[model samples]
Target: MSFPRSATRSALALAGAGVLVLAWGGSAVAAQQGSTTVEPAGAAFSATLDGEATFETGPITVTCAVSASDPGDGNNLVPDEPDNHNPEGAVGGPINAPNFDDCEADVPLVDVEVEVADAVWDMSMQDGESAVGTMHVPAAGIVVTTSGVASCTATVSPDADVDIEGTWTNGDPVSSLAFDTTAPIEVEGGVGCPDDTEAGFTAAYEVENADDADTPITVGP
Candidate 1:
């Protein structure tokens, strides 16, 4: 199925708003039984659950970033857009230009799917406890479009979740990570990402030097 940029942006924006609320001492909900959490880890990603299991929809952040270094900078490259037959949308066609001259140009990164366990009342951690939710990623990476802001989506039940995306320049760095909450959501049974995975939860990102000419992308927590 195709992803709706507006819908995803709304969902993620709402979630990110919830995170801000909690950060500012606002109340947030947790699932009664199942819950899931997702976060970024540098270039890799990870997820977890508490009570029941959940599935990820994959990263779905729509990127609108093109670099001056990118051969397609002036050509135009749109990512995750069905209309754009070429995902990289570089210039001169692949035959004329085989590789992305600005392959490292800062692009958006989003996780479309995240699987978690069903939330259970008595079998899981007490409500509002850290155990009830999972910590996904500490930070994420982002690409700025001609427009200044970027957005993404993340879903979580009874569990509280946060995922970050960073934006940086060669000298100065600034980052943003959209958040999501599936609180007050009901799960069939109580399950989450397995315990083994929980211990190794990761926080990945697609790093970019927004102001640099030859910036190489890096991924990490």
Candidate 2:
């Protein structure tokens, strides 16, 4: 489905050469749990969500969501058990038809686990190394990038929720930060480069600042 104009704003409220922002209120960005102090241009800024900034000819939209559900009826696959001790095995059949409990024993519930690794920040600038922001989800998960040139990072451990460990400098820095999804978490949405607006562009995506039903990203010019 196409993104609504409001949703578009939520995803593009911040854009720049190498922007860095902290998680706002309770949204879903990785760095929302903590906060990032803004710095001067070319200054050091660290939050979450990293890798080199990629440029695009036009505006690009990325849709992301996390979901899980109880096994529910979908968990049922095997048939009802029968009285093997009795010689008469013709009283009832399978749940749907002439089948039997043999099928029920094979049913298994498949759990759902989702992880969003990297988000792309489109702007103009070519660089091999620079500043970096890394955000971690409060759960054990993996990071996956839809568009960009970077590694798919973040693997939440089984006992830890997600959280950004720290930001880094790109010019040959330590490994990227990873999110933990299997434990208690305190943060949600955040921005790595809120002040770093793209050249000639004032509008960019942002996390939901408040609990109102308004758009998440606020566009400017």
Candidate 3:
């Protein structure tokens, strides 16, 4: 999300990220139950659904009441390397797919189920313009199940990349992660799937330290 990818999860909000920011694969992103973060130098962090997290595909919109990163430990700063994603340093995320609850669809009587890939999603913080950097959903696809009016299963296949944007106020974790931009999501499902193959995702997550609930996650230089 808006935060460092290699850092934490708002979802911990994929742009539905809680960019939970679930990841593709490489390192894990940390969440609560003791999720951690090292900071600007580089570290893992955890986040939660600040307000709400949503996923839209075709005409169907999925709304989740709760979202969070898989709880774990990590987000410590890595030493500088010649060609690392995090110039200041890099920290492998300690996490998995964001968890969801109270989820429903814009369409009537439709139940939505999301199964994040099992394992630590990839979280790589990109080199930023300043102390601030950008965090995209680590990587991995979300398996979504729809039943009732809509009977079918869909997956945010292969690569789902979304950014978690922030206001840049001294780089502090906020109550929400604003995906300043939209990310494209790919889907593969049965005949019950939406007519269109393309889908869009947007969301905001409230980020914080998983381990230290009181301590706000911050990125510094």
Candidate 4:
């Protein structure tokens, strides 16, 4: 199955958001509950990224919703349960899933939102070391907004990481940012597409500004 540019944008958006959540998880400060805004200290640059993504085997497709929020307690970054939330949280919503061969007929995936209540982001950019961070989605849940047997809420532990290599400039950002995963991101909860499936993806984007550039990132199967 081929994922269009829009689907890739959604995938990258989720990955980008995952980056922030994991970065703050490493050293999140105390904040109010459900606070969805965080700017990491010593951040060389940041941007609202868009890209497409697909499940490696089933080709399950989705689009991402753009949003932002702050980090929460790093300790509770990886929750033991699903749909868990911290005082400050991250939420992706209103995603639509079209019918796939493996999916039930006319059972479109709708209102798909992944909520992370507790998460942590650990990042480093030392020489010979790729900038990387891991996020634990404690109480993470994916809600199928559509109505059908496939529309049930499924628990997902979206443990994701981001690795990039480029020269960092305060005002001048790198020309582009490349993203990849070392292994397949596994999704639990008996959901089709990603659940019980290995999802691997690679994305590349042209950086307009190091400080903050709204660039379009593209992902390929």
Question: lDDT per residue, candidate 2, 97-195, as tens digits?
Answer: 000011110112211122332221111111112212233332323321111211121232324433322222222221232222122222222332222
Which model is ahead, 2 or 4, in terms of lDDT?
4
What tens-digit string does per-residue lDDT give for candidate 4 at 125-148?
211122222222232322122222
User: Compared with the true structure, what per-residue lDDT tens digits does model 1 show for residues 76-188?
Assistant: 12112232122221111110111101111112332222222222111001122222222221121111111112222222222443321112111112221111322222112
Clashes of each: 62, 56, 38, 31
Model 2 is weakest, by summed lDDT over 10 consecutive residues, at: 96-105
Candidate 3 RMSD to the real structure: 9.8
Which scores greater on lDDT, model 2 or model 3? 3
Q: Give the C-alpha miss distance for residue 172 in model 2, angstroms.
A: 55
The lDDT of model 4 is 0.25
Which of the numbered candidates is closest to the native, going by highest lDDT?
3
lDDT of 4 at 89: 43
Cα shift from native, residue 125, model 2 (Å): 49
- Assess each prediction's global lDDT (C-alpha) against the native: 0.19, 0.20, 0.41, 0.25
Q: Assess candidate 3 and give its TM-score to the true structure.
A: 0.59
RMSD of each: 21.2, 25.5, 9.8, 14.9
TM-score of each: 0.17, 0.17, 0.59, 0.38
